[model samples]
Target: MRNRHIATALLAASLLLFAAGCKKKTPVAPPPPPPPPPPTVVEKAPAAVISSFTAEPSTIVRGEASTLRWSVANATEVTIDNGIGAVSASGSRQVYPTSNTTYRMTAKGGGGDAVAAVTVAVTTPPPPPPPPPAAKASLEERMSREIQDIFFDYDKSEVREDSRATLQRNADALKTILSEFPSAVVSIEGHCDERGSAEYNLGLGDRRSASVREFLIQVGVPGDRLKPISYGKEKPVCTEESESCWQRNRRAHFVGVQ
Candidate 1:
C-alpha cells in the first residue's frame, strides 16, 4: 500500500506540472519576425556621377545652331534646365539653343543624382567688305616716251621748215602743262647718238635741248617755264647699236618737278 501511495503522489505531482505547462501563454516569435523584415524594402543604388556635358558647338556663330547634350554612366531618369526648350526625359534628349545658353543634366535614382552643365555662345557677323578704287598715277615729270622729238639735219644746224610741224606738237604739249600747273617745274633732257666725239656730242646735246626750249617759248610758252640739261650719250633709252635705237637716243626728254 505504501509503495502504491508513493507512486500515486509522484503521478499527481507530474500531472500538476503538465497542467501548468499547458496553460495559454503569449507566443514569443523571433521578435515578431523583426517586424516582417520592414516589408523587405531595399532601396536601389544612387545614379552615377555626371562630370560634365558635351555640346555640338561650344561657341557657335550668331547665325548657326548649337546642341547641348549630357550623359551619365547609368541613370533612371534625366532632367535638364534646357531653358527656352526645357524638357524632362527618362533617358536622354536633344536641344537646339539659340542665344547663349546653359544646360544642366541631372541623373536621379536610388544611388542619388549627379549634375553637369554645358554652355554655348553666339557670335556676330564680321565687318562689311571694302572697296577698290583707282590709283592716283599722275606725272610729276614730262619725260614720258609718249612724246616725240624733232631733229635737224646734221651741220646745217638750224630748225628746218620740214621739222616745224613736229616741233609744234611737242611745244604745244609743254605749253599746256606749264599753263595748267604753274607750280610744276619743267626740265628738258637732250641727247645725241655716238657719231661725234664725246665733247662735241655733249655740246650738240645742249644745243638740241636749248632749241626745243626756244621753240616752246616762241610758241607762247614763257621762257622762265623751261629748264634744259644735256645727257649726251651718257643716258639712252635703249643701248642697242641699231640705227633706230640711235635715232631714238637723239631726242629731248621733258620732266616736271613739283
Candidate 2:
C-alpha cells in the first residue's frame, strides 16, 4: 500500500509538469501594425496654369491687325485686359491697336489664379515732313535787286573811276540773267545833267550809253542783250540846279526783259 501511494504522487507531479510545458502562448497582436504609419497627410497644388499667351505678329504698324492667341490649362475662367473681356480657354482674337499696347490674360480656378502677358508692338512712322517749298524763279528781279544804277560826273560821257565797280556788278547781273534765260533782252537808258542844252545833253547821253554798252560787251555780255537809248535831260531824277542834283540826274539805268 505505501508503494502504491508513492507511485500515485509521482504520476500526479509528472502530469502537472507536462500540462505547464504544453500550454499555448498568447499572441502580442503584431504591435497593432505600427499604428498604421500615422495616417499619412497629403497636400494638393493649384489646378490652373497658363499654357500659352502669344501674339502672332509681335510687331505691327499702325492700322494693321494682329492676332492674339492664348491657352489655359484646368481653368474655369479666363479674361484679357485692354478691352478683351471673358474669352474661351484656348482661342485667338484679332486686335487692332493704333499705338503700342500690352495684353494680359488672367486664368482663375479653384486651386489658384495664373497670369500671362504678351505685347503687340505698334510702330507708326511719323508723317513725312511737308515738301520743301518750291524755289522762287525771278532771275531778272534778283539781278535788278543786286545791281545799282551807274552814275556819271556832270555833263561827262566817260565813266568815273568810282563807277567801275558799279559797272562790273551790272555786268555780272546781266550775265546771270542771260545764263538763266537765254532769250532774255535788256535795255540801257542814258541821261545827262540839267546844265547842258537838250540837244547837247542828248548827244552826251548817247555817248554815255554807248560807252556803257561797249564796256559790257568787253566783259563777255552778248551784244544782242544790250540796247542803249538816250533820255537826255528831259527825264532828270532831280530837277534842282545844284551840282549834287545834276550828278544824280546823269545816270545809266538798266531794264531787263524776258
Candidate 3:
C-alpha cells in the first residue's frame, strides 16, 4: 500500500510540470523602405550663332583647300556637319572638299545649340594663257610672288628655307623699286594651315610674316618698304590635309600699298 501511494504522488507531480511548460510569446517588425530615385539631366548649347562660323575663299574645286574661320566665342564646344569626323575644339580649321559641299558649325552648351555655315563652290580654276603669247611679269612682277610671299610647312609657324628664297626674290625686286616705282610698298600677310587654335594660330601668323620681313631686310630689301600682318590660319588656299593644301596654307602674301 505504501509503494502504491508513492507511485501515485510521483505521477501527479509529472503532470503539473508538463502544464507549466506550455506558455505563449510575441511578434517582430519589417525593415524601413529604400531611398527615393535620383533626378535626370539634359545638355544644351548657347543661343544665337557664334562669330567663329566663317569660310574664307568660299569658292574652290574638288580636292582643294578652303580656310574655315570662326571668331572665338563663349561656346564650350564646336562641331562640323560635313560628317568628316570630330570637329576640332580649337577655334578654326582648314577643310578640303572631296565634292561640292557646304560646311556648318554648331556650338553646344547647357543653353542650346548655336550655329554657322559657309558654302564652297567647286569650279575648275581657269588656267593661265601661254607666257610668250601673253605678257610676262617684270623682274618686279616676277619677284612679287617669289619675294613677297613666304611659304611654310603643314602645321608649322616657323619660317623655313623656302621662305628665305622668297625674301631674296623680294630683295632683288626692291633694288629696282626706285627705278620702277619709288612710291610703292608691300604688305606681308601671314597665313596658316588649319590644325589649331585661331587665337594661337593668328599670333603665329604675325610671327611668320615678321620673319619674312626680317629676312628681306637682312638680305637687302628696305625694311621701310614692307609691312607685316598676321592672318593666322584664317586664310587657307586649300583646306585638305593633302600636300597641295598644306603647301598653299604655308604662304605669306605681299599686298600692294600706296
Candidate number with greatest lDDT: 2
How far does residue 134 in candidate 3 sit from its true spot (Å)? 16
TM-score of the candidate numbered 2?
Answer: 0.49
Candidate 1, 1-258: lDDT as tens digits: 899999999999999999998896787756434444455555667556665467786887677767555556656666676543333433344445557877767776567777777777766767767654454334553435334666654432356687788778767776666666677777878788866678887888899888878887888877786888887778878888888887777777777776
Two-way TM-score contest, 1 vs 2, winner = 2
lDDT of 3 by residue, 1-258 (tens): 999999999999989888776555356688888887565434444443475566777887766888877653555667778874446455567788766678877776546567767887778766777569366455446445445556787666567865666567667866576346567777789887787688988888888888877877887778888888898888787788777777778787877655
Ten contiguous residues with the weakest lDDT in model 1: 83-92
**Positional deviation of residue 201's Cα in model 2 after best superposition, in angstroms:** 1.9
Better lDDT candidate (2, 3): 2
> Can you rank all candidates by lDDT, best first?
2, 3, 1
lDDT of each: 0.70, 0.86, 0.72
In candidate 3, stretches whose alpha carbon ends up further than 4 angstroms from where it belongs are: 1-148
lDDT of 1: 0.70
Candidate RMSDs in order? 11.6, 18.2, 29.1
Error of 3 at 114 (Å): 99
**Candidate 2 off by > 4 Å:** 1-134, 137-140
User: Judged by TM-score, which candidate is best?
Assistant: 2
TM-score computed on alpha carbons, candidate 3: 0.41
> In model 3, how many backbone clashes occur?
11
